[model samples]
Target: MKDKRDFRLEIASIESAGDYVRDILKQYKCTDRDMVRAQLFTEETMVYWTETANEGDILQINVRKRFKTISLSLSYRGAQSNPLAISDEEEDETEFSFIGQNILIGLSTVTYSYENGYNVITFTLKEKGTNPVILIIFALAAAIICGLIVNRFAPSLGPGLSASILIPLSKAFFGLLNAIVIPFLFLSVIASIFNMENIAQMKRIFRILFSWFLGLTAMSAVIAVLAGMIYFPLQNGASTGVNEVNIWTQIAKMLFDIIPSNIFQSFLDGNTLQTIFLAVITGITMLVYKGRFPVISKVVSESNLIFSTMLDAICSLMPWVIFICIFDMLLSGDGRVLLSSIAVVVLICICFLLIVLLCLLSVALIEKQNPLQYIKTIGPVLLIALSTASSSATFAPHSMIASNKQGIRDYLANFSIPVGALFAKPFVVPVLLLMTLFVGNFYSLTFTAADVVSMVLLCVILSVAVPPVQGMGIFLFTIIFKRFTIPLEGLAMAASLFMLFDYLMTTGNVFSINISMLHTEQRLREKDKRVIVYNNQKC
Candidate 1:
């Protein structure tokens, strides 16, 4: 592995590591400022890793320079310990506390992983143009201008063209995302379950994320329920046709729906919740009955590779899809009213995002790293989520940022993100809750405690189950409105209106998962004392 992009170091000593790193940065044309940071992070990391390694273990550094980001992926063997992932409380006593303070957990995004027999630690830095701040600014401005023109001057023309052409194109893009996302979710979740080094790691991370999941969902439900309690719009035109279903029957049906008699039917029907349930059962059974089904794991892993490659191809088209969606959305006559009506939803979602960010900062502080770096890593991804409002569209950016910037292990981030994108939803809950409330208020409907409980539970379950792509939110809202006897007239407006707010919800989720990954790594480091490093000869 000796290319301009890859370095294979057979030497044991760490003395030349600094010079090697500086030369690599220079070769990659990284800015002088980035060069300085990369060099410092690299030298300190090498020193720390080298000291942790057993005698005579080989060290390798792979350099990847992509536009405005450069990553140094170091792989070594002989120790399984991840000292680089130590907590702030444990930072003081280490021999390389300065290195830990200055490099591994410094200005760079340092992520650690143990693959095979080697510890692969990646130190990454923004090389300029890594953040999509400028792109987002330009996109927003362009969308606003284009939207206004299409709505005012060529209103009929825009809507007609959008309905006939742009909307379909966007739907096709969504279809493409749908095609890959389900398989990606199925395979990635199963793979993570199979590949987890520690069950407790997954449990702890799940507890935190699930708590946020429930809490956010509760927030949405509480707001909707409260709004329903006090707010009533003109009900002169309220529908008398909507009927509430039997709560007990619905609950039994929902439980029954989780498991399908024919697993293939779940896919054909696009029953994502059922598919996930099946995948979980399959994952657990396979994990318990290992070796009897080795080939299944291999097949799933290979399929995962194929789907991931497809995901990359589809992500390239996200910008165009976004353009079409915005064009279509802005052209609609209801766009203005929809936007105005959902201001509260958007405001509350932003507040939740702030809380998420605050929590991330706290975690970063405890981990003894700069929280801004976390923001930087996910900034580009967040912008994509904001613009596209599709988690599948944000996959590439999120994976890259989480891997490079947050230093989350490719294994953990890769597994966690796709699975999280579907099952780990934080945004849909609030949006759906708000929409349900809007419908009730707009129709002057009354809600009982049972209605609130059911709606809250539905928000949580559906948020996890529904794939947050185009129209999925609307689809779920329709189901809720019907189930709770809320008028369905406002579904169209509420759904269309929350497109902007969907951005915040998704951006918050992207941030939340990275936080989960970071927590997992820190906890793993805490429990595992042996920071193993190995040479190529044995592995």
Candidate 2:
């Protein structure tokens, strides 16, 4: 019938809570104890007592429970002391404000500060709910809307004004893109090659590369064929009598032109794809003969480092470059034309993404891995990729997840992702090429068998040359296909929509390639380990 005894205690540190709780409980270590209860508290929850306890006031003690051990500490304001508790009200205000500011600034910018007995936190708020990327998106949307409105309302003024506005923006975007492409390609390709040290490694790398190349080519061929069949682009209307330039002749001219009758002319002319070709050849030759010429080897090594630094600097500007590109594309009134074909491009992109996903699932199931687990492992990177639409930007996170989470080897992820970033435009090549064929048909431009081969070959070439960014593939597509009487403007229109889905399929490509490489490597390692175990057993 004895009433239960209670004790109250305080702890100096969360880390020492166990010892303090134990000592307090030892006090009630008596035979036939009726009942005992203990409650522990930290200063974090005891703000009122600390606040009210004056310089000399004995801190009021409360014993609501009894325990064998207890610890307590109290200090006046502004001293190095133990953790303290704040009342629910104070905690609520502070915690909620912290969370609110975090929401405003975004988690990436939220940071904490503690100084002079005061906790300070700061957050950066986007103006009018617009960050840089969002601002670009809005500007692009507005530009497109204005272009359309002006075109519909005042046709006479629209095209001229739109062209004037868009041309400059396009030029600037083109310049930025041009500046980045050569250096990026140079570093990415050379680094990828160097990452593969020997011929055996290169062989494996090429096997995967060839597989992807063939897969993309086959998919693009199918899409081009389907588009040709469905749209019957060439048979749609009266022949424009566009003498389908001999594909071979055009390719010969292209090859000749890329030799840069004058290198300076090529630079001034913004021949980026040509520049990439020249750079790759230079790098590969240097790599292949590094042993023969020490001087050339050293020069190449230093150049690679310099180029890598420059490439990094340029890449840091990619998000902004993409913004500028999107903005200019919108501002120039090109987006208005897109409205007509946007649905078609969007449908095509969705279908392409679905196809890539199906292919990824097939790879997963064949390898006896969980498809959903693979998807989840790459989910965050995929989201970032979708938002930013840059595969290289997704590289760090993708590599981390593949290596740390998915158990893929770091070397394989690092090597394969960059290489895949270079060549894996699964959707871009297929969709843009198909759209080009469709445009040709719409214009009644005869696309001969030669033209078809030309398109595929161009896609393959550009797939190799273009930096694997959001719209780079499409731009290259426009440059190449425009030679065949396909409207460059239509290709640009298709690109605008293609950019929206580029991230999804690019992520898919990275995921697929990484998983394939991982499983392949895992199987090889497992086989080697088994071999070693058997040899050891025989000994």
Candidate 3:
């Protein structure tokens, strides 16, 4: 069918806009939820325009479907006006009149511009349930099929095609990821610190919770190193990359090297350790002197928003990157190497499961609660985490379970869940360690004692420092693999496997957060009991 639909309606008859949107969305067989959202968006914009424009003014609407993206554009040729403008100076504009504007904004990608003397507003929405992970998997399968076909029929063309197209595109993808990681990391850390509410008031709980996060991550790192050594030892061809320098000296240098003499140089060099240090210092300075320098905070906030949106756009390219990378690997005869890494994937999954179970049991026994019952209570949260692969997406249901079923204090649960959603990463530590080791051994790059120490330290720091956002899995993989001086092929391999690991990693993170909250609640209760007993004795 037709990909484009358009309509011109009088401002007074704007109510019909909803019907127009409904008809177009239904043509694509969009879900009812999407239909309703489009209709609501149409109605809201129409109402706002109806109020702002003359009675007889005409509003032109265009709806276009491009693959999975459904874009709607509203244009009017009168004096410029933005229907989505929230703070326009109008006598009729009330706070209540703008109630649903933010919701509409959140529901879709909204843009406004003045082009060709017409004020245009556009809303772009994606079809629901289009899981990027599944898309990447399908792309991988398609690439394998196509690569095999090409390899059998036209063997001579494989090398040229890979060298010319796939290799350049693969480099471009990593280049984009590499360029964005440092700034994204810098802004995200600052934003996360600034986002926390009442840090002074919640310092006690924050310290306790932060300790739990670190403890879990450190434990995961230890497990990964030990397990990696057991399951996948260095082969005969592997080189340990050990230098003549003393291991202790290397450790000392790494520890002191985090403080950058020139911050700009640190940024230029893409030094994450120094970047993280700078971020912490800047975040705390902004937080302390927040009232004195409001403009810097505003700039930081706006910059974070811009970078976050750009990062999402980059992440959407992942499926394409996966297809090309896999296709290139097959053409280059590295398919066998990739196939051998299945054991590594399986091992990572098992380690995550074991960690989750261990945390659950430890928290249950310490709090005197039944482990089975705890699992049953948080099962829905885990299911959402597994399906969505987003810790924030599971926040609402997890909060409900924590407060109502688990008997966690409401305020504590609310505070802890948001903090956990952002900072708690139970799976990243182990996954990073294990994958790096596997790749190291694959490349015959041996890790000396100092190398292991440095890698583990870096893993634990990055796990908590990086915000859990879309595309962060790929970003983290790039950072960890690159830091270890592992080759680009290792990074590519890890990036390809991230689609499968993300779901399990997210679930593990959710599971660990739930347990940390339980422990936090228990500690608070015990502290209160002690205070009460001491006060009674004094009286």
Which predicted model would earn the best lDDT?
Answer: 3
> Which model scores highest in TM-score?
3
Residues 1-539, model 3: lDDT tens digits: 23444445445465577777787777776656456656666777777766566655677778777666567778777777666544424422242224323332332245566668787777665555467777877888988898898889988999999999998888887888889888988988887666442445456677887788777877788777677767865333234334444557877888899999998998899888889899999988887785477578667866776676677788788888878887888898877766788888888878887787788678667987788888888999999888867665665678789889988877666567656766678688777777788777877777665567677788888888877666777788787777777766566567667767888888888888888888888888899999999999999
TM-score per prediction, in order, is 0.53, 0.53, 0.76
Q: In order, what lDDT does every prediction score? A: 0.57, 0.48, 0.73
All-Cα superposition RMSD per candidate: 11.9, 18.8, 8.1
Q: lDDT of model 2 at residue 271? A: 65
Better of 1 and 3 by lDDT: 3
Distance from true location, Cα of 205 in model 1, Å: 11
What digit string (tens of lDDT, one per residue) describes model 1 on residues 413-490?
A: 555665566556665566676667665654566554445555667677667654443345445655566556664445
Error of 1 at 296 (Å): 4.0
